[model samples]
Target: MKKQLLLLVLLFLGSIALLQSQVTGTVTDEDGTPLPGASVVKKGTRVGTTTDFDGKFSIDAIIGDRLTISYIGYQPKEVLINSTIMSITLVSGVQLAEVVITGSRNPNRTATESTVPIDVIDVKQLANAAPQVNLNQILNYVAPSFTSNTQTISDGTDHIDPASLRGLGPDQVLVLINGKRRHTSSLINVNGTFGRGSVGTDLNAIPTAAIQRIEVLRDGAAAQYGSDAIAGVINIILNKNVDELLINVT
Candidate 1:
């Protein structure tokens, strides 16, 4: 009787092991594109796995278990494990505002640490916000203090638009590329504009693709960089980490 009772207990334990199931799924975007690097985790548990290159994933779970899926730039999802296979779809999330860098010759300073108000725009954010290929137009919309308008028929000035900061002349706003002084445009704005006699830098001369990020110092820096930076200063940092070729048709 003792041996028979021990055998019954072993069988019950074996049945519990067989009841546990393996769950498999594929994570995709709303458009059905496979989203690699998406995370899958068991709800209220530490067990998790990231989707493979093909957006496929597998995890050990049982029936009635809840799985949570998430990815960057996409909405998270939760589903009950009713079936062994699941096809999870995630929607795109709203784009967050880019953070700005402030108050330091060193580019590594955070926004909280600096006392001066500064605006920083990354290349990705600029490309998305820019309506046209012109760099001046991008800054006009992104920077609150900067302003520019496309000229219709003003000879050579029409090609190069004048830009100003804090309602001041464009020349008063110093331009810097990679922390160095950028040359001013030869075409001075002799027309009736905010920057009438000032020869400002041709902001559109530099392609948006080549830039890594732009830091605009909203405060006056005459004591730091001389009279040219009376209104403010703009520092355009070039892209140094180029790993892949980017082709822009428009």
Candidate 2:
């Protein structure tokens, strides 16, 4: 009885060896790009190994055993271990939730490359170099297309010293502070000033010390910025200096 039991145990072990073999394969995407660090495991068992940088793996398995493979950003796959060599391709999975882009300080896209005619003026440099004392006076000397005049006799409209651009009326040009519309006085007719029939803002109120730069768009933008910006657009950017003090001497 003991000899019969020993013979049966030996036959059972030999049959198990005949059914098993070594399997090898490569894992990749539809584009044939190797998927490094991919997971490869046998079904219903913890025995498994990960693919190398070349997306190749070797594992021991029996005939008809199931092999599961998976990777990050790719769909999972399963294959029957019928052949010694195999090729696996995984499809893409998941998607990016959101994406953002910013170009505020991109040096390649400077003012010179603008499609419209634009004049970028450094306020701090001009105030220190030029002899002009006010914003109106400084711009008058630098920009020939811009014009401004003091009013004394027309409906009390001299407070703002209305300005114009591109030989257009004073009300035609639009003024913006930090890209927002600056408030202006009510419409009124002028008799003794070049900016006659003006409804303009107070340019003198804005000190040069508080400004960083000025962007002058000398183009017809009525279709884009409404009728008020028909002649052009003047945008003022404020100073963003940190941990420093600025003193302007008159």
Candidate 3:
């Protein structure tokens, strides 16, 4: 009878211990404000949860469970949970140096060929750059060599700034989006139908949000991108693996 009573006592203690093993913590930004909807995930695993409105979250785990916290516009953080902490702070994200596309026509060109002088901009930079509705706004401060000249015609319609590729005229340069040719908007307003309003990728139509990176030859390129590539070549790479939900409004 004593043995039976001892066994029951042990089983009850085991149940209580199991219930106490869950891990929990609160997540906040650098400013100490609660970050609702921030994702907390296990390192290298799909198991994860989002913080509640109160910035609180809980998950079942054992000792040494690695956790990763991530949110938009913030640097992702990782923590190893050996003990319980009431709150975790996440830092703001900064742009790290990235491999920019360069010198494709001559595959032999070394990585340091900034001599060609291409201005490559990433989509994420657009948020901080705060560009206007048209591509002209984004390019205005990008390159000193290129100038954007917009003039209003007799009608209320505003004229687009001609993309001057080293003053070589728009027809000489080739504009490609993801290697595909985009139709010209109207005639190259500068050169007439033959040149057609400097027809190239309507940088506006491609949506800067969808761009991953841009590669500009900055030098003459007739062999690789083809005949129209006299002035220079501007190639826009689209983001294939990006989530559609990452849209931002200026």
TM-scores of the candidates in the order shown: 0.53, 0.52, 0.46
Q: Write the per-residue lDDT of candidate 1 for residues 66-177, one digit (tens) a residue.
A: 9999999897889998888999999997566886776344444324446676778776765765666767887887777788888777766788888888888888889999
Order of all candidates by lDDT, from best down to worst?
1, 2, 3
lDDT top scorer: 1
lDDT of 1: 0.84
Candidate 3 root-mean-square deviation in Å: 19.7
1-250 per-residue lDDT for model 2 (tens digits): 9999999999988877757678899999999998889999999999899899999999988778999999998878888888878888989964668768754322322376777767778877887689998888878877666888766766666566778898888789898999999887675656666666667767878988888888888888889889999889989998887578888788
Q: Which stretches of candidate 3 lie over 4 Å from their true place?
A: 1-118, 130-133, 154-160, 190-201
* Greater-lDDT candidate between 1 and 3: 1
Candidate 3 lDDT, 1-250, residue by residue in tens: 9999999999999977765577789999888998999999978788889999989999766557889998887899889988655478989875668868753333332235565555575646665766554555565555444445555552211444456567676666677878876555563464332233445434555666667766666778787677677788777888888655875665
Whose TM-score is higher: candidate 1's or candidate 3's?
1
lDDT of candidate 3 at residue 126, scale 0 to 100:
62
RMSD, one per candidate, in order: 16.7, 14.8, 19.7
User: What is the lDDT of every predicted structure here?
Assistant: 0.84, 0.82, 0.68
Off by over 4 Å in 1: 1-110, 242-244
CA lDDT of 238 in candidate 3? 85
